[model samples]
Target: MNNFFEVENVDFVVGGNTKVKNMSFSIEKEGDIVCLLGPSGIGKTTILRAIAGLEKIKNGHIKLKGKILSSEKINIEPENRNISLAFQENSLFPHYSVEKNILLGAEKNPDNKDKKVSFNEIVDLLDISKILNQYPHQISAGEAQRASLARSLLSKPDLLLLDEPLSNVDQSQKEDIQEKIKKLLAKLKITTIIVTHDSYEAFLLRY
Candidate 1:
């Protein structure tokens, strides 16, 4: 796999305490999904937050495509790093319609002056076309998750960071939802990293 985002000996310290240990990993354009597989509170989300520039790394380096995105001496803001992150919740605007929220990121893009990806495509792909006129509060957790995925992808992000996307969905629907998400990601040729505690879900991502 060609290296895209590399984290070397990264550390996060706060209140004179170290949270993240000496961590090192590399994610690339052609790489398979790598799970951070560990128990809760082991700095998994910390790693993603650090990469997204939401948390400050006190040491080591984070490089994206050979460019230093974050380091001890320098820090790049989240929006400029092409690192699109979708949290477990709070990914959409409660007031704006689905189409508006999906195209929100395109406004910051240098290209796509007219927002090339049509709103209907995203809505249909996510199976939320009927809910496009509805607010975020009106959708199911699964529907909201799909909208979040679509929103992040519409940004044309280089790296995707998902945090337990299906955690809130029903157990019976987990496998099916994961399959759909995986298919959409493959279709888009997007580099994705999914953070989940389910072993079976992670196993399916190994391909």
Candidate 2:
């Protein structure tokens, strides 16, 4: 049988240069975590963006659970794709508390009756219960990253694209966060693709 998720011959261009040229890969099972590793400016993040529908693909296609998401003839809107992307910059709402910020994601996906976890379950799973009332700037980089992750996972996305998930965390906290995230992804069984420049971090995320 074929894999549950696939990216076939995807080509992405930024400016005039080709970033991801004919890239292809797949995840064979649910709850599997995959990592894309490369040097800076080598299109790792670009691939994730393309898979999440944030960037348009110039060629080839991306499929989730055997459904086509992007191609030359068809393109699905980001929100309608049941895909979520969490970037390295920590795109949290400074005006909203952590709980409120995450709640927004859960609200958007109310149509998804397949969601197996509740909002409070996600917050507790991410260990952000203590900082639920804190604003973005009031929390540490690690805390902010966790909150952003919680927001993404709360939606119970079919595909989770994490661009440098630990980039905002301190070096000392990378391993702990990576382990926690790995466990949570496995528990939730949300197919995930992670982009990272650190080889050690990639190794730590091994299933």
Candidate 3:
């Protein structure tokens, strides 16, 4: 398969001991949704962190669409990577209003002056128009999760990394959010990666 992502002969070590040794893999092709399935603390999120330029790799390289995203030889910064990430917690700005956070891309990026999903459209899609004026704390975890997804989409992400995006939600609330995620992701149609232990949620993400 043509690769959208490629990690070759990579090795990373963090903290005093956490290490991923000689790891190599690739996304099947462009638009392929893949997951790194393992128990917690298995360097799953670390892998994503490496890909997102949030962490530095000790060795080897990461290429997205044939452009090097990261490597010890050439480390690219996170903002320059075109990768939007929504981790389980601390994904949104607590100080900014939901509308403001969603439109941050347009604010930082003048080139996106004509994005298809305008601020209003994103708020409407996530049913967050009511909370557009609310801070991250004012909304429910589920609502914030949805809003975070919307914000990521608004960035026109080249690759979207969801690090267990729904882990903070209650079990009963998970399916609803999971469905919303599937629908929203399907609409956005980008190269998406989900980090989670929920097999059911994984099934829902089986696009």
Candidate 4:
């Protein structure tokens, strides 16, 4: 049986240093959530970047739905990959309100008729409705993270990659937000790969 997503013997190098070497993994089916869990600065994020087509792999193959996305000779552009990546830093636009930032994701493909989730649904799920008008600087770090996630989900990506999604969330509300995100991904049946340094988070998201 073919896997839905596969990364085989991949190497990712940056600034003349090899960050990830000979890594291999796969998500066998759609709607599956896979976590890359390890200590910080161990190339977990690089793997996600490779899969999302943001980083070029030095060797090996990254495949999605039986199509080769990246290899020694083939590198697909990030925009053409139909993948959404939510950065760890919650890279929201400083000038735009939270609502506008989130809406930008949906605007990527205005002609797409089969949206997996609506704007209201994502806002409600992530509990960011109250802060829609607030700018990224106006909200807490946790709120910014959720807003970033909301934007990624709204894009209706074939593959969603989240980088340390809940890292900035308070411990008190971390699990709650994780559960909500897990359920939302399941409901939408989105194939997801989350990069996290916390084993507990990996367990929560994967199982």
Best by lDDT: 4
Candidate 2 lDDT: 0.83
TM-score of 3: 0.86
Ten contiguous residues minimizing lDDT sum, candidate 4: 108-117
lDDT, candidate 4, equals 0.89
* lDDT score at residue 153, model 1, on the 0-100 scale: 67
Clashes of 1: 0
Scored against the true structure, residue 8 in model 4 reaches a CA lDDT of: 94
Candidate 1 global CA lDDT score: 0.74
Error of 3 at 119 (Å): 3.5
Ordered by TM-score, highest first, the candidates read 4, 2, 3, 1
Q: Candidate 1: which stretches are off by over 4 Å?
A: 14-16, 30-32, 108-121
Please list the C-alpha lDDT of all candidates, in the order they appear: 0.74, 0.83, 0.76, 0.89
Between the candidate structures 2 and 4, which one is better when assessed by lDDT? Answer: 4
State the lDDT of candidate 4 residue by residue for 1-207, as single tens digits.
999999899888776678989988999998899988899899888888878888788879999999999999999999899899999996999999999999999887666665567899889888889999999999999899989999998888889999999898889888988998899889878899999989999999984
What clash pairs does model 4 have? none
Which residue pairs show collisions in model 1? none
Instruction: Encode model 2's per-residue lDDT on 1-207: one tens digit a residue.
Output: 878899999888666567878988999997788989889989998888778887788788888888999997889998789889987886998899999999988886777665566877777666789999899999988888888988898878888888888787777766766777788788778888888998888877856
